[model samples]
Target: MSRKIAWIAAGGLAATLTACPARTPSLPNTPAPIHVPPGCEKNQTGEYHHAENPAFLYFGEDDGGTLTLGVARAREGLEGPGDAGTTVNIVLQRTPDGFVGETRSTTFTPSGTACPVRFPTEATACDDKGLTLRSVAATSIDENCRPAPTGPNPQWKEQRLVRGAPDAGASDAG
Candidate 1:
């Protein structure tokens, strides 16, 4: 019967379509690979110092493409007497411009006040020289003693940090 033939044709078309493999959709654009700079390479970890600002950046392990670090921005001459430095914790991802990431900074005031503040930070690796660190902070402090999220737009600050030498006065005993 023609009705049976029509059904058979439809069934055959369905079978053929299911038998064909589906094509995968390709990405329109692929991101370029990240460039790792010297002193920030895998397994290269240590403390770097910013002489002018009296800050310190301690680099942790560069495992799995992520770099964790601690930043200590000394406030010896920048803040009131008895004020310590500002410390920032950063987790940076490898980027085309070295490493970029967010930071949480805590400024220690002379009155023992400290609070977490969010900000953006960047770092660039150099050829056996040091790292160029760029960071931004709100100029004002909130009532809660935290760094305010207001100021000259970004207030970007930069510093060049070199490898710190071992302290001669430090004792080996724990």
Candidate 2:
């Protein structure tokens, strides 16, 4: 019957569509393994200082070689974020079971807010300057160039206070 033939054709098309290979092609739902930039030394324990700006943005392996990322702003130049300071920490612990990425943002002043937004990521985080920190590769290059190879995020005005090549120190070592 023509009805039977139509059903057979529909079934074949459905099977072919499900087997298509273009489902998803992207990085895993989490950040890649942390890679410490060259020329920077990891502290005996805790995060390594990758860049400095009165405060420090630290990233590297800790005492047990556990990869971690953190930012610290403190009074009296305290060494660790737990001191009289606050911090934002992102730790990636790999295990046989799975990968665990724990991120915590410390607020200097309690806003007494009743919460509005639910989910927030690094890209949504803003600093005291009200500017978001852009992502730079381990080599300090703007690999993705979200803003531009030489441009910063929120690309409205030119406001890169520290201007230089990412690997300026490595190149100047000679």
Model 1 spans > 4 angstroms off: 1-32, 35-43, 53-59, 72-87, 96-98, 108-113, 144-150, 166-174
Spell out the clash pairs found in candidate 2: none
Per-residue alpha-carbon lDDT of candidate 2 for residues 1-174, written as tens digits (9 for 90 to 100)? 999999999999999998887756676587555433221123323333323443343443445434355544333434554333444565543433222344454322133322211112222221222222233222112323222255333322111112221332322111
Per TM-score, the best of the predicted structures is: 1
- TM-scores of all predicted structures: 0.58, 0.27
Question: Please, what's the RMSD in Å of model 2?
Answer: 15.4
Give Cα distance to truth, residue 124, candidate 2, Å: 19
Candidate 2 segments whose C-alpha is farther than 4 A from its true place: 1-47, 50-54, 57-65, 74-85, 95-102, 107-111, 114-174
Clashes of each: 0, 0
lDDT of 1 at 10: 100
Q: Considering only N, C-alpha and C atoms within 3 Å, which residue pairs clash in candidate 1?
A: none
lDDT for position 124 in model 1: 62
